[model samples]
Target: MGVTRLVSRRRQDPGTKWARIAMAVLATVGVIDTGSITLKRWGFLGELTCPMGADGCDKVLNSSWGTLINGIPLSLVGLIAYISILLMTLMPLLPGLQENKADLSRRTWWGLFTLSTSMAAFSAVLLGLAVLKIQAFCFFCVLSASLSILLLVLSIVGGGWEDSGILAFRGVLLATVVLLGSLIWISAVDSGRSANVGEKVGVPPAVTNESSIAALALAEHLAVGGAVMYSAYWCPHCHEQKELFGKQASQQLIVVECATDGQNNQADLCRSKRLEGFPSWEINGEIDSGVKPLSILADLSGYQGSREF
Candidate 1:
């Protein structure tokens, strides 16, 4: 009789159905946001159009803190998190789960609370990095952080928890854990911080990758064609462009530092060119932005060199 009464009460309890729907919608948006970034990073998609400008988006996404130790994009992690939240949000609403709806709802609410709390905490850490460390703003990152925080708020106010004290305790503990973990992870992956010791403040890390013979020949060809590369010292995509040419080949190309504080800066020249983004290339008096592949550069510059790169 006691078990029957408990089950009956559980079934009659008014769960926040509206909150779940709202969360699902937000999670779906998050999935699309992060998924697109992941695809772009992996070369599955072309250049992404940033809301305000592409410079901040390029710098932040191509920075040292952008990828995991295994070279996986950090956006993929957020994508998985959003997908999990979306699935959990919809699980209890399945028609087949009606018999266990109350029980499932209770369990999934706890899961949502825990997951969203962690996501919110980690997003805070990323936001701090973007503002303080990277000194670049990414609209997508801000959107994800906002979504995480909103989901957290919804999880709290929408859960309709019977025990507020327990929820508070768990939330605190989860947040603390996520905070420490995020700090440690950030410290580990921040190669620029570690490599920049005693160096100029805005200088990018040196490229150590060796260039192939073909790459060197292409670099020479681009130089003869009057192709010039304009870059900012603090831009990771600029560094990436250098890495592609390798140390030896990079020296053969005519490079202009665009950052005002960068060594050998040609700020006046860069401004005259009206450059919109870093790692811009000027071939045949035509300017193009973003990191281009060696083959693309060769074609753009009308290089007849070996295309091995």
Candidate 2:
């Protein structure tokens, strides 16, 4: 008799129906946002122009702090998480999967709570990195974090739990452990990657002499064609671009130092070019930005040489 009454009560819980609807809506938005970022990062889509300005999106995207979990873009992980949340949100509504037993329904609630809580914790850590470490505003990152928080709230209030306090305690414990573990793992990976980049950045231009003569001629042509590579000495990306040219080709290229402390500093010139990012290039009076490949540079400079770099 008691079991039947408990099942009847669970059936009439309004929170279950409303929470399902809310989770579906939130998860859909999350899917679109994270998917767009993932596609862009993977080069399936074009570059994103941040609404906040040029210094906003790319800066955060290119930063060492943004590289999470084995150098994978954080957006990919978010995409998977959002998809999982969406699947879980829809599962309880399926006729065959709906839990008729009261205890099973409680387990489902706990599972949802755990997922949402862990996501929220991770989002909080990302928020901290954005503000304190990266120090840049990213619309996509903020949107993902916001969605995670909303899902967490819905999971808690919409769960319709009789003992909310106990559930809250367990959720907090799970979230804390997940957040700390993630931080430790990410930090270890980041340290190794940073060391590798440091070594690459420190390599002398002489080490790049192995580049072919054709590459040197292309670099010279780019300079004579009124092309300029705007760079800051302190920018790792600028060092990366220079490394691509090697010493001989890089010397022939028209490289402008935009950093105030750099040799032959051209801060005013860079500002006039509206340079807000590192490794911007001016090809025949047209400005193109970011760390461009040598092939693209050859095409832009109209190099008809051997094409061997």
Task: Output the number of the lDDT-best candidate.
Answer: 1
Report the Cα lDDT for candidate 2: 0.74
For each candidate in turn, the TM-score is 0.82, 0.75
Q: Estimate the TM-score for candidate 1.
A: 0.82
lDDT of each: 0.85, 0.74
Model 1 pairs in collision:
none
- Model 2: per-residue lDDT, tens digit, 30-139? 99988887776665776665677544565566666555665477788888888888887777677887455455556666666788888889988877877886566888
Residue 258 in candidate 1, Cα distance off native in Å:
5.3
| Model 1 worst lDDT window (10 residues) | 3-12
Consecutive 10-residue window with the lowest summed lDDT within model 2: 1-10
**Model 1: residues with Cα > 4 Å off, grouped in runs:** 1-15, 191-193, 196-198, 209-214, 235-237, 256-280, 285-309
